[model samples]
Target: MSMATTATTVSLTSVTLEVADLQAAHHFHTAFGVDPHIRLRASEAHSTGFRGFTLALTVAQPTTVDSFLGAASDAGATVLMPAAKSLWGYGGVLQAPDGTIWKIATSAKKDTGPPTREIDAIVLLLGVEDVKASKRFYVGQGLTVARSFGGKYAEFASGESSPVKLALYKRRGLAKDLGVPAEGTGSHRIILGSTAGSFADPDGFAWEAATSLAPTPSTESAAA
Candidate 1:
């Protein structure tokens, strides 16, 4: 008698992280080596690799983790670690509120290089109402305003705490630059780093002011 044979197939899916701020999370992830072309929407960010996996970011409050998990009962997102105050003063975790196990932490013991990464290089831009006022706010928050071009653009840095430099520019103009469609509110998003606070520009462009994490090896390499 002949026996029948069947082949099994498997595919990798996208990984999404629920963050308090979309733009901030984008900034942080970009610094960690995620590409920006994957960001498909204002509220959503994406990154891709040949390894066939994706990373996404969605907004959620720290206190809502339990509720989010409850809704994703079938999705298999378990709390690898519960949400709690981090040693760095912000909420930290090593799990997703509604997905597979992933490392999520608020620490900057990653990048130790000066904050020289350009905004264009990392796809992070700040939208502000008043460039000068925004510059002042960042400076007061411990960032060093490196320079201000004309009266409409400003650059700030936090040294080795982050890899990307922060910028403050006119909101509408920034939207035009990024080719973002006109919408209602003009709030930006940013991810707080272990050593810096994530915030938006005056115009609402989000930014992540944090250090980069070391490059993670591909799963194939581990298997090999």
Candidate 2:
């Protein structure tokens, strides 16, 4: 893991969701952790079916994949797909009550007997109408391409100490992957934060570029 980064470097820290119910959305996401590193943008507009994007949570072990989903289920999250051993790895999908989709998986190739209940990382996958265009746009924005496949998917490796992994996917295919209808998602409901300056992707996911603020001294008292 990398050390904490200063405000000088513009980092994509959080992925914001335009949620209809503020309290419900906050409650559901906060369950991931006291800090899943996300921000929720409240909204009144109602959107149903697919939102054309999904958040991926990477776990450290195969058993941990199941454990995360198990805990998620216990927390009132709807299980889109139960955790099972898959060709790629042990993984499954889930949907928050607010309609945001999440895919959880572990890179651990073999099934380790027990689960650890951990979410090691979160990657935001945006579904774009044109994969090539999206790829070109991010690369043009000074983001290096970490990996690409058949022009359908692309992942950019962020050098920030704790960064939200960024990636892109084919719009319709992504909806299919999340098992949601390919319609009725009005605005994609995504808000990306970065130092790269505010802009929207070709698919309409918004990015808010933040100016780094100086670090401040702690106000708490020292105690033994």
Using lDDT as the measure, the top candidate is 2
> What TM-score would you give candidate 1 relative to the actual structure?
0.39
Which candidate leads in TM-score?
2
TM-scores of the models, in the order given? 0.39, 0.82
Least well predicted 10-residue stretch by lDDT in candidate 1: 6-15
lDDT of 2 by residue, 1-224 (tens): 11134334334655667777667666766665523466666775556678888989998787777677776677678998787776777788998777778899886788656666566778888888888899888766666788999679998876554447888899888888777767765667667766677787777778776432223211111110
Looking at model 1, residue 120 earns an lDDT score of: 22
Cα lDDT, all candidates: 0.36, 0.70
Model 1: per-residue Cα lDDT over 1-224, one tens digit each: 11113221111111123334445445434433333322212333232211111122221333333333333332334443454554542222222221112222233333334432222222123556677787776555455666788668886543442333445666666544323332333212123232333444344333343234333311111111
